[model samples]
Target: MKRQIVLFFALAMFSACNKSTKSNATQQPTLADYRVGEKWVWKYKGVTTQGEIRSEGEDTREIVSVDGELGMTIGTDTIPVADMVKPDESETPKYDWPLEVGKKWKFENSWTSQDGTKGTQSQDVEVLSFQEETVEAGTFMAYKIQYKGTISNSRGYSADTDEVWWYAPEVKNFIKLTQTQEDFFYEEELIEYSKPQ
Candidate 1:
C-alpha cells in the first residue's frame, strides 16, 4: 500500500510539471493587441560629439479619425494635411495615405524654427523595410523593429537613415526611437502619453 501511494504521488507530480511546462510553452508575445488608433508622443534630445547639446522642448502626437478615415498626427499637426497631402481639395487629403512597404508619403513644405532658422524640410517616407525581433530591456520584453529609409532636408541633400524602435509590452508604448543619419544620431523617448478623448 505504501508503494502504491508513492507511485500515485510521483504520477501527480509529473502531471503537474507537464501542465506547467505546456502553459509556458504555449504563451507567446503577440502584437495584434496593439492598435494603431492610439497616438504616441516622442520627446527628442541629443548631444553632439563636439559637446554641443541640442533639444526640442516637447512634441505632441495624436491619431485622428478624418471623415471616417484613420491616420496619425505629430506635433500639433496632421500628416498629408500639415504637409497638405492633397492640395486643391478640402484643405486636407481626401484619403488617408496607406502606410506600407514601397508606399511613399511626401511633405513638400519647408521647416522653420521660431529662432529664425529656415530649411526646406520635407520627409518622403518610403517604408523600405520592417522586421521584428525579440530584445530584453531591463525586466521587460521588447520587440525591436527597424525602419530604414531616407530623409532629405534643405540644400538638396539626402541622408539614408535607420530608426530602431523598441516596443515594450509592459509599457504598451514605444520606449525608444534611435535615428541615425550620415553618422549623426538622435534618440527620442516616450515621456508622457494620454488616451484620445
Candidate 2:
C-alpha cells in the first residue's frame, strides 16, 4: 500500500509539471514578456536557384524606452512593443493564437512594399510540430510553423511561396526562418540574444 501511494503522488506531480510546460507555449506573448535592453541579432542571406545572391546582411533589434514607452527597433523604425503583441485583428493572421502542433489555418495579407509595389499574399499556415531547433544563438524548444501558398502583385506577377519559421516561446521570438519563393531562397538565423540582468 505504501509503495502504491508513493507512485501515485509521483505521477500527480509529473502531470502538474507537464501541464505547466504545455501552457507556456500555447498562449500568445504580451508586452509584459519583454524588457528594455533586450536585444536580438540575426544573420540573413537570400539566393536564387540560378546562384545569384540577392541580399545578405545582419539585422538587429533591441527593446528600448521611448518617452517612457517600450519600443522595439524594426528596420529603420521603432514601434511600440505593445502594438507588436496586440491581439492580431486580421481575419487571417501570421500567427494563430494558442499555438499547437498540427493546428492549421489560412493567412492572407495585402501590402505595398518599400518601392511602392503592391502585392497580396495568401497562405495555408500550420503548426507542424514542436521540437528543439538549434541555431547560432543556441538550442531552444520551438514550434515549427509552415506557411505555403501564393503571392501576386499589381505588376501581374505571381509565384508560389513556402516558408517555415522556428518560433521559440522562451525567447518570445522566432529563432530562424526559411522562405522559398519561386527561384529565390532566403533564410535568417539568430546569432545573438541578450537581456539585461
TM-score of each: 0.40, 0.87
User: Counting only residues 3 or more apart in sequence or on different chains, how many pairs clash (N, Cα, C under 3 Å) in candidate 1?
Assistant: 1
lDDT of 2 at 188: 79
Clashing pairs in 1: 80-85
Candidate 2 per-residue lDDT, tens place, 122-142, comes to 999898988899999999888
- How many clashes show up per model? 1, 0
Runs in model 2 with CA error above 4 Å? 1-25
What C-alpha lDDT, on a 0 to 100 scale, does residue 67 get in candidate 2? 99
Model 2 lDDT-worst window of ten: 11-20
* Candidate topping TM-score: 2
RMSD of each candidate? 20.2, 13.6
lDDT of 2 at 36: 94
